[model samples]
Target: MLDLTKLSQQMQGMSQHINREAEASRKRIEIALNLMEQAKLNSDNLMQKHEEFKQRIIFKPATPLEPLNHYPYIVEPPLAHTVFATDGSQIAPSAHEIAYCYLINVGRVILHYGQSRHPILDSVPEIYYRPEDLYLSRQWGIKTEEWMGYRRSVSEAIILAESGQQLLEISPNQQLNIPTLALVDGSLVYWFLEQLPSEARDLILQPILQSWEQLRLANIPLMGYVSASRSSESLSFLRLQACTFEEPNCLKYCPGTGGMSATGTEKKAPCQVCDPLRDTVLWESQLKPGQRSPFWRSNSSILDLYDHHQIYFCYVNVGMEIARLEVPAWVVENSEQLELALGMVIAQVQKGYGYPVVLAEAHNQAVVKGGDRSRFFAMLEQQMIKAGLRNVGISYKEARKRGSIA
Candidate 1:
């Protein structure tokens, strides 16, 4: 059991440290805000600086598409539109379980506003027990939880695309002109693929690329909504503005060294003024509710593999918190579709009280509670017994945890 009494006693000291950190963070935010103003004043030259130093910068900074200080108010949503969202959950394969299998459940939701059609809400669950599904390579090792998470993200996007296509096929002829927005739960940029080998990354990315292509072909705007996002792409741009050097070279004039060495050799040090700030810190006060920041193209190397589907992102104030919305280049290029997507997202947040209703519903449909997990194992055990498996049982550790003697 947790020692609440000890934890309570320690809270006093912890609170003091937290306060000190908070004060330091406040100072950093003030400096960052000043740098942001500088960035806005030098907005025209900012992109040139980015282009000059992008190859050498150690961190990922977003490429700005509009002026840095631009914050546009929300546009009115279309009178009649549909929002489709998909989310996924997975049960990781465990060695201590009675059965060596995993499951992926994708929940899909379709909400139509100003239309008589009923909302669509459902989940599709699939089980995987075959060796091919469980292992990427027997010599390398069984697929890890991280791999499973990437797979789940891919599955969510694919389902969202399929749902959008189905909506287009079934909609009435008049409703065809009405806008549709497809949303997924998180970042569209597959940053996780950066660590995997080319072959392994291709295996996960090709399917997601195909899904994005399908959405693009159907002229459906697909987006990923991240709540309370900690992304720093915007902050990174401001950091570049904070650099005192005319040409910022992270390696030649490293942040770790504070500057070049006495012999003109390169060393590195963190930026004392900007290192502690996040993009949200600078925008939380600047952007009013229903306002969104300017768009920026993600500089992730993974997007190099995206082919025609490069990703762009912007920050939005959703009343409760700042959210990051990522979309493909096609969505950003089409002014009408982009506005429709932003308006619908803000409207959804209002309807759901600070969160997107369709996404929330999809999550509700995807979540796997503890009781459901227990029931799933029970059913599996019964089926195995019926199949004449004599030695089917959970490992000792699992049994001990399930029924602790203490």
Candidate 2:
């Protein structure tokens, strides 16, 4: 049991620290806003600087597709439109359990607004227990959690693509020619693949890219919605403008405090001007409810693998919080698709009271409660026992955790 007295004492110190940080952040935001205003006037110079330092900057900076201060009012959604969303939950492989296996459950939701069609809601659950599925290699040097996460992401995207294809097929017969939007819960960029081996990366990424292509061919706009996002790519651009150095070379000027190392190593140092500002804070201050900031292209290294399906994003104020909406390059290049995607997103958020209704429903379908996990293991053990399998049991530590006795 936790000691309440001790926790109370620690909480007081934590509160004081947070207060100090908050005060510092308030001052930094003022400076950042001033820099934003300057950036609007000197947008051309910033663009030039971005081109010059594109390769040297360690942090991901957004490439602006519109004016620095452009905030467009949310376009009203079509009276009759369809929205499809998918979310996934996973049960990581545990050594203490009866079996060294994992589970992925993807929940899908489809809602038809301004029409009488019934909503579609369902979940797909798959289990992987094979050695090849559980491990990256025979030696088990690499953990399966990251690989499993990648697989789950692939499943989510594939499901969305399949959903889009199905919608397209039936739309012609059902006369459902209204606009449609597909949404996923988080980022589309597979950042984890950056460290994986090429073979492993391709094996995992190909399916996702194919699914994206399918959606493109189907002419369905897909989006990744991140709520209360803490990404700082936009702020990184501001940091470039706030650089005091004449050349703005991150490596040479902003090396470690002791300057260049003996080995001439390059290291990233935080800019004193905009060290802690986030994209959410910047947009939250700039955009009104139901408004969206100008679009920007992501510079994530993983995006290099995205090819023509490059990811672009914008910040939308959904009343409750600022959300980062990531869409494919194809969707952004087409004005009709872009407007339909954005309008549907804002409408969905409004209907769900600050969250997308389809996403929330999908999350509800995908979530696995603690009791459900316990029951799953119990059923697995029972089935194994029935099959006359020997040595099928949980670890002693797990047993103790399940039932503790003084």
Candidate 3:
């Protein structure tokens, strides 16, 4: 870059001045040698690089990543006797406190479909999620715009992880707690479960699995739910997908330390134009993992964009409808972030259809699984008995198609 020339000139001038000053002072001229040595370092490196560039080894660019198996909307199945579809939303802080929201679609409740807003997982903490720990701002002040954006995004994700965990831990003491399947909206679940530095994954999942043991302790069934919406993170992702190539700055890639060894080469050359935001994005992508992806991962992979986890609610041995759900866009980041519901993901859960016979009441339903557990269960049973034969013993096989879980 032209900047290199300026830096070299400045360094040479300083070296020349140092030598002159040493000679005049009649002091240790050896110190001037050290200065000259430092000044010559870049020059020598550049010369070596120039020579290497003349005969640099050629390697074919990587073929595009073949996506893994095509995905099916795999959701969790309701526990035996009752299927519960639940989703959560949180209002988290964002840039300029303008607020970026996210919605969790949990699982689909086919009954009383359309728009519904009852949180089936009642005991969840309903806490806000953030990715940054104070440690981030402490080490790098807010003056660092890049760090600030990272902090905001990460802090929000962390809030998601914690709050999501609470969502799973809802009830612990119900008798017929029977099996239960939980569904969530959006991508990337398990709170970075797949992300770990080997030892770290084991360290994290160990405790997480233990926590889930609570359900086993209570003899209840529980499964995690997840949903994905590419439209949520950035428009650039969509743009990248729609096109085959983008300018280096437009597509996501970092520069080499010397602007040659770093990654991010299109099928041909890169963009010559300079864009501040794009440059910052490249820098951040280099420093962080998974360039251009909305979700988080430790690996520097291109396919991370589309590769998401699918936690099943039922066993392959047991056929059940799996569902994914969605809430409004505005509710996920700003506003209440708690989406009552614009959409509900529907699918069969494993184990069984849950046989939950709940009616659509004000976007609410009571499913009675023929068991005495919590007052919630009692109320549900009453509702079922009151409903008469029309909805009793309804099979999810039938309901899966009908979209009737309520």
What are the RMSDs of all candidates, in order? 3.4, 3.1, 24.8
What is the C-alpha local distance difference test score of candidate 2? 0.85
Q: Give the TM-score of candidate 3.
A: 0.25
lDDT of 2 by residue, 1-406 (tens): 9899988877878878999999999998998899899888987888888788777765678889999878989789889899998889999999999999999999999999888988999998988999889875434355788778778888898998989888877766553477888899988776778887778888788999999899888788889999878788888778777778656676676665435566895433655566667889988899999889999999898888989999999999989999999998999999988998899999999899889999999999888889878888888999999999999999999999989996
Local distance difference test values of all predictions, in order: 0.85, 0.85, 0.29
What's the best-to-worst order under TM-score? 1, 2, 3
Q: Model 1, 1-406: lDDT tens per residue?
A: 8999988987878878999989998888888888888888987787888887788778778888888778999897977899999999889899999988888899999999988889999998888788777776343442566667877877887898888789878864745788889988888887778877787787789999899889898888998998877788888777777777788777787646544678995554444366656777778968998899999999988899998789999999888999999999999999989999999999999999989999999999998889888888899999999999988998999999989999
Among all candidates shown, the one with the greatest TM-score: 1
List candidate 3 stretches off by more than 4 Å.
1-80, 84-88, 94-174, 186-208, 224-406
Candidate that beats the other on lDDT, 2 or 3, i.e. the better one: 2
Write down the TM-score for model 2. 0.92
* Greater-TM-score candidate between 2 and 3: 2
lDDT: which candidate is best?
Answer: 2
For each candidate in turn, the TM-score is: 0.93, 0.92, 0.25
Which 10 successive residues of model 2 have the least lDDT summed?
265-274
Report the number of clashing residue pairs per model.
5, 0, 42
